[model samples]
Target chain A: MTRTSTLSPVPPADAAAEPTRVAVSTVIFTLRRLPGSETASVALPLVRRTRDPHEGLWALPGGWLDATEGLDAAASRTLAETTGLAPSYLEQLYAFGAVDRSPSRVVSIVYWALIRPDEIADASDENVQWFDAASLPGLAFDHNQIVDYALWRLRNKVGYSRIAHGLLADEFTLAELREVYEAILGRRLDPANFRRQVENSGTLIPTDRFRTGSHRPARLYRYNQDVELADRGPLDRRQ
Target chain B: MTRTSTLSPVPPADAAAEPTRVAVSTVIFTLRRLPGSETASVALPLVRRTRDPHEGLWALPGGWLDATEGLDAAASRTLAETTGLAPSYLEQLYAFGAVDRSPSRVVSIVYWALIRPDEIADASDENVQWFDAASLPGLAFDHNQIVDYALWRLRNKVGYSRIAHGLLADEFTLAELREVYEAILGRRLDPANFRRQVENSGTLIPTDRFRTGSHRPARLYRYNQDVELADRGPLDRRQ
Candidate 1:
């Protein structure tokens, strides 16, 4: 994705004496079925900070941005460190740079990701743990607000993108897919409307597999990889 | 809008000896009626750099991220320095942080803006000049590519948001509004369909004003101020 065009060549400014440092953080979202419950909800991984201004509190998994690495590389590194998996779906959420966000001035280029259920199988690590995004307690820094924005984005993107693939298994029945939306949106959708919308989107590929239930079995479908996971426009092709 | 939630309280990482610096830049869009042409086109302001590296080459207006300023403040400062006006219809576009983007390690937090026609009246300056977004010359650094991405965002946003308010005047006839869309989209939209879509959107408030010409008078419509300029979700309320 390296290009002469997007590659900037302007001279750097005179460095500030007490220069602002950059940090890369992530809000990686996944869906977890509540213990002893049939319903699922949006969840994310957070690392209990070994040390902090707010010590012992959970924080989004991230590390300092190395001068030698690009922002995306730094984010992917953070993901691997926490999840032990390659980045499946990732996008920059925002750059949080309040002068007082931290005791020292640090700007966090935050990213949000969606890890499919299959991808979450090997993400176990002692330091990092998954928490329901809706029920988080006092988190480090402005993390609580950050998670809310990320959830809003995830829910909003689901409306227009085939990003459910990033949360669901490789194959899912329409009912199962609807559950993903219902969880994020916190409400039920008309089953018939949901079917027509995804059908018209043309991103679903019907599969022979079927889920046998107490009633009639429902055929499964997977996302068409050829169709874009989402329309990020130029960012998609450049990356 | 300040909440204790989004603020980070974690201790800062060991500062790199030579830390990556953050710079702010913006691509501000407006409609310009090219000389001898009735149709307008999407355009933006660029300032000629006075210092070396890309000296004399036009670049997106920006400056160093002051140690005490937040990312939004820095972006708004850049916008003010460029246009001498308060930030209008601005959004963080992307954070470009390629290691080799500059000779020095610089991470640029870029923003894109839309300036209404009436707002462009006072944006006259010698160092800064407007360039057609489609036909930008080899700009300073990655500005050519940056502008392309900004324009892509502008076009994509136009399809789903009432951001047309940011480019159009206080009250405009349907024909005038359609021109703004055609200019950004670079193609003609069916008038009947455009009318039906916008009318159904219910974001327009019919005004007593009308544009009388050779054709029958056309009623003018203004955006419903109560309606948001665009659905930015959580960021709108937070800001």
Candidate 2:
């Protein structure tokens, strides 16, 4: 995605003595069924820091920004390196740049992503471990706060966007879809109200297929690709 | 805001030869009524580039990230330096870090701000000038695209948040508030619908004060400070 460089040239002497460094990080979320329970919970992968500043502590999977790629590219590369899985949905979360965030002056451009449950099987890394989003340990740096913000955004976005599709298979039962929202929001939604709201949203298309093995066969539905995953307003993938 | 650096100490030898530099930029939007015009339009201040790349081209008000300051502080400082005015509302917009977007590997944490009409009086800088957002000249770097994103966010946020209060005076009639939305959205919103929507939002506090004019006296209102400027969702000003 390299194009002609457009910024004005700066003299080496004019540049500051210590340039602030940029890093890329991601909070990848998926759902995990609790052991011995039918309910699923929101879960995310955290990498144990191998070196200093909070060494031995869990942190979001990330790395320093590469000089040759865009921010999004860097995020994808770091995510793959750490977790070995491509995200079904990825978006820029926020840029954290408090002076005390790191030893050296480092600004982290954090991204939040969602991976389908089936796709999580592809992620196999030694240092990476999954933890329930609701019960995370003290993490490295300000990652605890970062994760909190990401979770808030995920829950808020689910209310309006079709991003729940990112965590589901190509087709799913209405109950399955409601479970995804329930896991993120941590609330028991009235099943009938949930069904009515989702059906009216127009982003779901009922399929002819139905899932068996349940007391009553529930109809399967697919997302309308025509409608966007979410309303990004006028934004595209350009940046 | 600086504290003792906590990250594992990096050997100077391990540092990258060229670290990615972080820059802070802001898009300050306000409403301006042109001479003899009845309706207002969205306008923003821009700084002219004085250095080599895209020199003499207009760009958003901004500067480099100071190593000692937090991201928000950097944004506030740079914005004041560029435009000589403090914003009534400022929020992180987006981070642009395309390696080829600049001559150097620069990552910009961009913010969008809103200034009330009274505050615009303080913004009289030499290189700073206001331009109609709808029709801007080719800007420096990827700023043309950045401005487009900020405008999109501004229009989108106005629909949901009390950020419109940032563009209004302390006390105003319902008609005045609607004008801010109309100017930003570039359309005439139905007065009745707009009134009901805003009143139902519970973010406005009706006052006994009224403005008597050529027609009927309209009651004035103030924003409820208890309600947040916007729903940032579990995030605070810590950044």
Candidate 3:
């Protein structure tokens, strides 16, 4: 995409002095098996700030928006650059622009993304570390609130969208699928109900393959790619 | 509400030359009776741009984001300043920051709002006029695409939220409530099913008042104040 440089033929004299910097941030959630817990819990990666303002504090992985890239592209670039992680399911969360949110006027176009557990290997950055989304420390700026909102969106979208598929493998047992939901929702769901509900939704394709577990072999199912992970509606275009 | 001057302690010398100006805009929806239609249709106020970069074209009511106000406050201020309407239901829509969206880079923190028909009397601005949202002409910037996204959000949220209540007065009949949905969804709905659904949802309360229409006296129902108009979840606080 080509970038537009200036607003007017004769630019405002004070534009440079009061430029509103645009930043792109992401809340990347993945399920990590808790230390001694039987089930996994939702976790996200945060990067420690290196500069002043909130230096040494943890914040969402992000960077300044490049002039030539679209918002989605900018988000993907930032996510990849900071944590070396790519998201499976990415959606714009919110535009946080409180006057006092930053030391300078900064508008963050926050995107929430879902990363599969297997893709978490790239989080080898020294400044990057995974933390339980539920028990996060005091983060830089309004990041704590931003994560809370992203978590809310994740839980809310999981109910109606096939977003849980983003956190799972290509094929998984019903038990595995339920585990993802349980981890994010922090609740135990009835297996029978979940199975019936997913089956009735027609978004899952039951496969002949089975996962051999300690107790029994369970049927594996793959998500129907025809169904979108999230309903973006009219704004589904890549732009 | 104090504004931060700049982001860095030592301001970038070329900040104005490569500035990311922030703009605030709103898509305020209200029900308007069509010329001959029996039911009201979804309508929104549009402003005629008098400046370059799509001059003389109709656009969403908006203004440059002030450095001193919160996003929600900026949206409310712009909505009132340009269109002279205050939204009963106001929610962040999306941030549109495509590189080539304008002659200059503008990150618009767009908001979609709902105003009751009774509140539209404040819309006396000559440059601001109401238009059928379903058949809007070409708009300024990427506003056409922005409106499409907002319309989608409106239709999608109408299914799960009490946003329709924003288009109605405190006391309204079941038929009145159903009309708002039908207008927004652009389809007919079974009155019986809608009544049962809204009744079971427990978002409305039956009042002793009744609207004595030409046919029959339909009982007037008032929206349950205890229930929120929309489920913002964890971000319900007015940031």
Instruction: List, residue by residue over A108-144, the lDDT tens digit for candidate 1.
Output: 8998877876776544456567898889988887888
Deviating ranges (above 4 Å) for candidate 1: A1-15, A122-124, A159-161, A236-239, B1-15, B121-124, B159-161, B236-239
**Which regions in candidate 2 have their CA more than 4 angstroms from the true location?**
A1-17, A122-124, A236-238, B1-15
Docking quality band of candidate 1, CAPRI definitions: acceptable
Encode model 3's per-residue lDDT on A37-133: one tens digit a residue.
8988999998888777888888898877777788899888878777777775578889988878889888889998787888777544578888999
What's the i-RMS of each model?
Answer: 9.2, 8.9, 9.1
- Cα-based RMSD of the predictions, in order? 5.4, 5.2, 5.1
Question: What is the DockQ (computed on Cα atoms) for candidate 3?
Answer: 0.29
Candidate 3, superposed: residue stretches over 4 Å from native: A1-16, B1-16, B159-161
- What TM-score fits each model? 0.90, 0.91, 0.91
- Report lDDT (CA) for all predictions: 0.75, 0.79, 0.79
